[model samples]
Target: MDLSETNQTAYRHPWELSRMEILLKELEKLNIRGEVLDIGCGDGYFDKEIIKKFPLITNIWGVDIHAERCVHQGKEHYVNSYNELQKDKKSLILF
Candidate 1:
């Protein structure tokens, strides 16, 4: 699916929207609570999505190869590599 160059929120592939909801629901059902490090987090979009759905997550951090594409909605931090975030052992890694 191709997203519009102007606004990503205005356009999304079906899988992009559905998968995020499914993942969030599964995470909630599992009742996982801890700092979360999202790997390959493009623009931190899903980071915002998960945090919005699961308030139990104490800390949210995002890592991606393309640092220029990273985005944050709240206190979330975006890094370029897993090694940067892996220095802290407290986070629950997600891909």
Candidate 2:
């Protein structure tokens, strides 16, 4: 995960997810496009933030293995398989 680093942006602390300038900048760049999909979007809270930050995201897809996690979050689907995601071009995003 972005919050934890292991040769892959391992944050020394979880709070660092918000403190990292580079990450924020990268997010800003992507947000400007206002169209991003977060696959395997766990709780989808981050997805909601991405939509909020961008606002241009006309379509947001938040898929996860646990339907409980996607409950009533306005998430399109809470399916459990990667194949189920391929139905959309946004499926390019994978965990």
Candidate 3:
């Protein structure tokens, strides 16, 4: 039931993931869209839902430690150890 394990593509804790998926589908019905950034996106399971449910999203980015604890194939979103996330006009969605 641990879908968040190893990128098998399921929610980490099971029910928590299921509920979020249902909610995201409902939001899609309202015509909402934008870039999505999944920080600490552990296994990027939620990111998968965002990509499938939200077609309006033009880009998807996720960041996590390069280890088994957080290994997900993302678009290479890495900030230098000294780098800071500067907030500009762009949107930022964190979970």
lDDT: worst 10-residue window of model 2: 2-11
Candidate 1: which stretches are off by over 4 Å?
Answer: 1-6, 71-86
List model 3 lDDT by residue over 1-95, tens digit each.
44334346432565766777786876667665666666666666667777787777766556555434344355354444314434433344655
In terms of lDDT, model 3 sits at: 0.57
lDDT tens readout by residue for model 2, 1-95? 54223232232455544644454466666544433456566555566656666655665667666656666675355456556654544522424
Error of 3 at 5 (Å): 5.9
Poorest lDDT segment (10 consecutive residues) of candidate 3: 81-90
TM-score versus the correct structure, for each prediction = 0.73, 0.54, 0.56
- Superposed Cα deviation of residue 62, candidate 1 (Å): 0.6
Note the residue pairs that clash in candidate 3: none
For candidate 1, give the lDDT: 0.67
Candidate 2 accuracy as lDDT = 0.53
Q: Residue 38 of model 3: what lDDT?
A: 60
After superposing candidate 3, which stretches have Cα over 4 Å from the reference?
A: 1-13, 65-71, 75-88
Candidate 3, number of clashes:
0
